[model samples]
Target chain A: MHAFYSPQLTISCREVQLPASESRHALQVLRLGVGDRILLLNGHGIRAEAVLDAVDNRRHSTTTCRILQADAAPQPQPHITLFIAPPKSKNIDAVIRTATELGAAAIVPVLCRFGVAKPDLDTIAHWTKTVIAAAKQSHNPWFPEIKAPAAFADVLEAADDHGFFGAVPEPADALPSPAALPVDDQRQTSLWIGPEGGFAPEELSALLAKGLQPLTVGQWILRVETAVPALLAVVLDRCQPHQRETAE
Target chain B: MHAFYSPQLTISCREVQLPASESRHALQVLRLGVGDRILLLNGHGIRAEAVLDAVDNRRHSTTTCRILQADAAPQPQPHITLFIAPPKSKNIDAVIRTATELGAAAIVPVLCRFGVAKPDLDTIAHWTKTVIAAAKQSHNPWFPEIKAPAAFADVLEAADDHGFFGAVPEPADALPSPAALPVDDQRQTSLWIGPEGGFAPEELSALLAKGLQPLTVGQWILRVETAVPALLAVVLDRCQPHQRETAE
Candidate 1:
């Protein structure tokens, strides 16, 4: 079934109206009409089966969907918090979407010493929309909390769990593969990926001082967008068994 | 130092002329003049340092560079062959680039029942160039051999090595995580990822009959571009220890 984002949807509400954008997609793009079944996600773990009750094709169309069933999805365990320095324009969207698909619990954009883009409020809003669209497409019930840009030091101070920073390690300091990292089921895990130029020396020192272990995903240097998903995949793979056990 | 693709480069060559595209990039984009040093790769494990001897600035400019040093990078171990059904226009470039960065030994475009695009000679040429550029950027000496699009059944018939196909497994038949898969250092590993619509029922049956284990990178569905890197990262992580041991 096709899924649509309906942020205000709740179990108590038997009827809901999809947002204008989503309504157009359901009506025009997907050709969904009255009595057509679809799934609805509120980005807060609530997923519902809904049938289109009324379709309005006006410029400001709002489709009313009647809820048939509602259920809460189990939240991802070993909650992953990704601290990333935003790359250039479209690449940031790629990072956000891929991170969402990989089940990141939250995404924090950190401002690093050598970071490329300084994201504005509008950019953050745009990214939030991107995350929501990705969540609906991937059937992810929970959407990652997209935090505003924060200073590297501020983010480091706020990080209180097991933290790993992505960097190409020097030969002598090569870290173990993610699979070999000690699995800690109790604590949440967070990954930090720097921008194209990488973290400056002082920033690296600050991360080390804050007890973030350095991680090398692969030998070759990766673009920021590529590294985000690559690192997340490795981290998620390491945390999968624990998640499965917890789910059981 | 910057790296440029020099497809015909050899160890015995004392001096070489850069391709038109590379020359334009070196002179106009990077503004490198005579006496500038750069690295060159032949996309076949040979990497060389070269000093620009003469640079022409005209539209059809070709720069001459003298080789200063040359070395062969060892090929990646447990060579990976990726058979992916081509996605839409630009995403095909992304798949090839990420596959190159992750050290795939060969990339074969397979035509599937649900595949969207039929790649022609020009598409293949474009994808090959994308791999070359990615190889240079990632400092990978071994460029994956890009093959013409082949029939899905033909690929299945030719597959003899250990094979894994990317698919979201049924809950009752969940496959082991890539990291948990038994490791065999002697055998080359191959992975097959279907197009956006996913493998048809018969295609999945054929893959399973040929003993290709189903593999899921994460819980959520992923786009083709995202899935390529995510899957590669997991596979490379599983293959890392053997690669390190081989390096030693």
Candidate 2:
């Protein structure tokens, strides 16, 4: 069934009205009409099955849906926070969407010594909308938070979670050996990605002092955008035990 | 250091003439002339530091780089093979490029029940060039083979190694329990990605007989392109330790 996102939804209400945006989507774009069945999911994680009651041409042009069923969503696993140096706008947008789809709990953009792209408040607000849009599309229970920019030092200073830093250093000083892969405790984890030029020598020095695990992703160097998603994929895959069970 | 790829290099000679393509790139595109320093890599896993000895503007330009040092690269572990459901042209190209950067050994285009896109041999040939370009840019030790199109069944029939399938299934057959993560081994591992429409019920049924691992990348559904890189990142990270560690 086609689903829609309407934050203005009320719980236990028999009659639900679509927001103007959703109203236009159902009536004009998707052409859903009275008695047509659809699903509505609020950004807060409520899923509802309903039938369209009517489309109001006036009063913000609401479209009412009669609820057939409503239920609470189950909880997701250990949280993931991306404390990355911002890339260009396009790549950041791609990262936000994919990370949200992949179940990242929060995304915190941090400033690094080599950081190149700096997003303004308007850009940050746009990204927040991207997260909301992605959460809706992926049916995720919670959208990842898009935090304001911060100094790289602040990222390491405030860290208490199991932390990761995407870096390649002298082999001897590399990450805690893979044998010491994080134990499956299901606690929230953090991933830090550098910019196109990657972390400068002194910045890396500071991050390591704060207990950030300097890990290498693969043999080749990945771009800023690719690095973020690749790290998320690897970290989340390692952390989620339920995912491992599927392999026979 | 800037790296350039040339297939015409001979392994034992320790000296090589730039290929026609590299010659043009060196002389014309980059406008480099004699006495400039450059790095040349043989797509066959050898690196040479050479100087631009000479360049001819007329009748097939030529250049030379003397070997400062050379080493054989250790092969990537778990020998990844990406069996991606064919996506739109641009998306497919992006998937191939990103997967190669992530160290996939081969990229096999999969034809599945839910796959809506198909390409001719000419198109496949073009994508092959895309992967080669990506490999050079990433400076990856190995280049991924772009395999011909195969139905999901054919791909599985030819998959002599372990297989993991990405599919959405009912709760009764939810992916293997979380504890069964595959043990890292010095073996090739193959991954199956669903098409945009996803695997049909019957396609997944085929997996049951083959005992294919129906693992989910995570809780949410990823677009076909995102799935390719995300899945590779997770699987390859698990695969590295068990690989035969031949020191480069």
Candidate 3:
């Protein structure tokens, strides 16, 4: 079944109206009419089945649907929070979309010393839209919370959870792999990936002082967009056994 | 030092000439002149430091440089070959780039039943360029060998190594996480990711019949570009200990 984002949808509500944007897509593009079954996602782990009751293609078109069934998906364990410094505008979009699809619980944009692009209000809003679209496309019920861009220091101070920094390994040193990290279900795990030029010396020192372990994805230096998904995948894989144990 | 691709570069060559494309980039774009030091990558694990011997900016421009130092990086262990069904043109680029950055030894585009786009000669050539560029940007000395697009059956027949198929888990079935798979350094690891709609029923059956274990990246359905990196990171993480052991 085709899934559409309906943020206002709730299990308690007998009938739900698709948002204007979704309505236009369903009516004009998908041509979904009365009695057509579709899945509704509310960006809160809710996947509700609904049947279209009314469809209007007017300027203020509204596609209304009656709820048939609703279920909340269990969120992925060891909530992954990605703190990334934005790359170029286009690359940042790829990072956001890929991070969302990879099941990041939250994405926080951090301003780093070597970052090329500074995030603004408009950029943050655009990132949120990208995250939502990614979720809808991936059929992920939960939308990753997109945090406003903040300074590296502020982000470090706020990172109270168990954290790992994705660092490019030095010539002779092999940074610890994520697989070597201990898996703990009780604590949330956060990963911080720096800009293309990497974290400045002071920033690296600060991260080490804050007890964030450095994890290397590979020998090569990965771009911000590449590193985000790469690091998340490794972290998620390391946390899988813990997830299975908790489930049982 | 900045790195440029010099496909003809070798340690024995006292002086090497950069290709016209690299020459334009070095002389015209970067404005590097004679005696400037730069690193050269041969996209086969060779990194040579060289000093510019001659700089020409004409239409058939070629920058000649004398090799100062050379070293070949050891190829990454457990060669990873990715057989992915082509996504949309733009997304396929992202997938190829990320896969290269994550250190896939080779990439093969496979045509799947549900694939959106068919790969042509032009697309294959474009993918090769993307891989080489990604290697340069990521500072990887080795560029992944980009194979011509092949049919699903041909790829399956050639995939005799240990293989994993990225599959969406059935509601009640728990697909093996990539981390849970046993890691062996003796065999190459190949991953097959389907297009957006995923592999058809017969494709899945064929994969299973060929003994490709199904591995799920996450609960959510991810885009091809997103899944490529995510799957690779997990596989690489799982294979890390083995790599270290082999290195030692």
Candidate 4:
């Protein structure tokens, strides 16, 4: 069954009327016909069984999906937020899309001391669309919340509630242990990663002061994009294993 | 300190000259003049401090570097081998490069039952180049070895001596744990990851007959690239927590 993401179903029936973009994909690209079965996710860990009611392939790139029946809801997925010093435009776009597929709950673009890329609100909107589309592709019910690009201090202030930073640490220092971050009750987590040249020395000191962790996956040097997923793999590993095995 | 990789350092050192390609990178791209200091890593994790003596920028892409004084040897880095079903070319590139940065000892391209993209020898060469390039960039003394791509059963005979396979058990069954793998002397370890579509039922059965386990990382549907690094993160987490702590 094909899967779609529609977060609009936060309420009863949790029905998702496929958005124009998704409809185009399902109808035109996938050529999925009406009455065909498909799955819809809200990025909230809910899986809904929806049938294609109508595919208006003309002007409206929307697929009217009728609720057939909802499947047994998955256990609450981990809430992971990413705090990254947004790299160049295309790079950040790639980060958002891939991060969503890997199950990040939110992405906060940070303007760190050494950060080289900072796009305006319009650009952020475009990035937000890219992330939404990715979530839809993965059929992830919970669409990761994309925060408007924020300054370094704002991120620091939010550190206690929904923030954590990632950096390479001194040889003798230890990263936060696996036990340090747990997923017993769905506590939201934010992971911060820096840019190419890395966060400035002062930025490192500031982030460290604000309780950011200089996490390390291994001894080798990793590109910024590689770091995010590698870090998530570590973070996600700490969470309980996958709940239900899906059919291939 | 800047680090470079020089695989040829078995014997002489009176006037150690860096490879031509490295010389160009140091002298041209990085613009390190004579009398400048840098560290050259002889792919076993030994980093030697060298001063630029005669950088005759004779050729555009190749310059010469003569070693200066004391040979500074960093600790020998561990070797991690990833025997993975070659994913798409791009994803394989990601794996080799990222794995190298993450301190993989070597990479063995294994053609498994579900292997989708069968990379030819030329493609294999390209991937090996990627690993080499990543080693230089990550500043790893351990040049991850790229074994010639081979058949799946061939692996049983030559399973890296310290290798482990990542397998998730069928529903209701849990995969065997890493504790099962032998850890005699931390020799080269090969980690096997199935294709994105996962292993064939028959393949899984055959491997089970052997004592080797299809170790499962967790429950989530991890992409091929994601699975290797995540498991490596854990393996790196286990055998080299001391190193991860230091690398941070």
Top model number, DockQ = 3
Query: What CAPRI grade goes to candidate 4?
Result: acceptable
lDDT of 1 by residue, A121-151 (tens): 9999999999988988888889999987899
Go through the candidates in order and give each one's C-alpha lDDT.
0.81, 0.72, 0.81, 0.67
Model 4 agreement with the true structure over B41-134: per-residue lDDT tens digits: 7776555567777777667354445665535434433456777888888788878887887887777887887788888889978976787678
Better of 1 and 3 by DockQ: 3
TM-score of chain B of 3: 0.91
DockQ (Cα-based) for each candidate: 0.44, 0.47, 0.51, 0.36
For model 2 chain B, give the 10-residue run with minimal summed lDDT: B239-248
The DockQ value obtained for model 4 is 0.36
Model 3 chain A: which ten-residue window has the lowest total lDDT? A177-186
User: For candidate 4, lDDT tens digit of each residue in A1-248?
Assistant: 67776756543573467877778878888899889888877656666788888778675587888887775445435667788898887677767766876778778888887888887989888987887677665555566788888898877776654345566634554445432343343355567798775677777777767755556777656777678777775665444333111100
**Model 2 C-alpha lDDT per residue in residues A17-37, reported as the tens digit of each score:** 887787887787777778899
Best-to-worst ranking by DockQ:
3, 2, 1, 4
Worst 10 residues of 4 chain B by lDDT: B239-248
Error of 2 at B72 (Å): 1.7
Candidate 2 residue spans exceeding 4 A from truth? A56-61, A169-185, A242-248, B26-33, B57-62, B169-175, B178-186, B242-248
TM-score, every prediction:
0.92, 0.89, 0.93, 0.83
Is 2 or 3 the stronger prediction by TM-score? 3
Off by over 4 Å in 3: A173-179, A185-187, A242-248, B173-179, B185-187, B242-248
